[model samples]
Target: MRCLYCHAVIHEEMSWSDLLFKRIEDPFCGICKSGLLEIKKENSCSVCSGKMEGSGTCGDCLIWNEHQMYHDVLHSNRSLYEYNQLLKEMIKRFKYNGDYAVAGCFRKKIIEEVKKLPRQTLLVPVPVSEERLQTRGFNQTEALLVMAGLKFECLLTRKNEEVSQAKKLKHDRHSGENPFKAIQQLNGENILLMDDLYTTGTTIRRAAHILKEAGAGEVRSLTIGR
Candidate 1:
């Protein structure tokens, strides 16, 4: 076998516990596995899934819930991993460097998580504009989900002449309206917006706003990193 990220030779072995119980299927080798920063089940904001003090929702979500500019969008969000250095490199290679095969690293795990959600899930991936589509050739978010066998569509389109979320500063993101517009209306259905990363919560909030305004019943987001 081979390690997925580093492409090093993976020596296969099993411990005594594996013989008695279920065998371990470790995708990453020891060094690569050590770099994976999974999100711990800790006290976090119910809305954004961010680590915070106490059991209550974080102040950031509270501000979003109360802020006039937010338009009462963004119900809740969940993420699988933290935005650690290792994850940053993985995302860069997959997204910017055009390594589509890296999607396999999270395919099974993402599918497993999606299964735990409510049935009849409307998996709507955040869309890229024609300009970006032409530049990147493939959408990074869509690439991660191509194997999930779930019904999905690009409901949101990026506005023309808009700077990407990546280029915007933290304060700049919060000040302006999102650059996405809904292409269709959804009526009283559960929506799970899929994206690659969750940063200052601006993009997801903006996307959720349009989804809610378009009549979605409940809008939640799932991201690979937070």
Candidate 2:
């Protein structure tokens, strides 16, 4: 077998607990799996789940709230992992290299978190531009949700002129018309926005604003990384 991220030969070895409980085999070897960083509660920002120095919200979230960058902003965001080098590489492979299978690495984790969303929460994915969608041949966030057995709606319709969000600079990302619009009214009580990563919170923030304008309430976000 091979490691999903590294593609190294993996000589499968089961732990004593796995043997005793007949646990489903893990695809990764110990070394590779150990590199998959899971964020601990104490280390993350209360609002954005980014790496924080102490208990309160991160400075970015504070500034965003103070300035109403995303009016009717999200209630909060929950992220599962830190955006470390390992995760960056994995995402690059999955997103840029067209290695779609790597998306399954987060399937179990995403499904587990989706179950915790509030009732009547509309699962809305961050849509890509027509240019990106055409090049990639798929919506990465939607694929992640489907593989996790979680359902989501492609509510936001992105403009044809825009490119991948990853390719934009920070300032450019914040200043644009956001390049997205809601296609249908979301009359749900809660909106749970989904994305693969949360960087400056720009993408989700823009989407959240559109969802609110379309009738979503108490918006929140869930991301694989922050």
Candidates' RMSD to native: 3.2, 2.9
State the lDDT of candidate 2 residue by residue for 24-113, as single tens digits. 345466776788788776888887888777677877887788766575478888888878888888888888788888887787677677
Tell me, by TM-score, which candidate is best. 1
Instruction: Estimate, for each residue in 179-209, the C-alpha lDDT of model 1 and write its tens digit.
Output: 8898888888888889899998988888888
Clashes of each: 0, 0
Model 2 C-alpha lDDT versus the unseen true structure: 0.79
Off by over 4 Å in 2: 1-3, 7-27
Candidate 2: lDDT of 10?
A: 81
Runs with alpha carbons beyond 4 Å of true place in candidate 1: 11-26, 69-72, 147-149
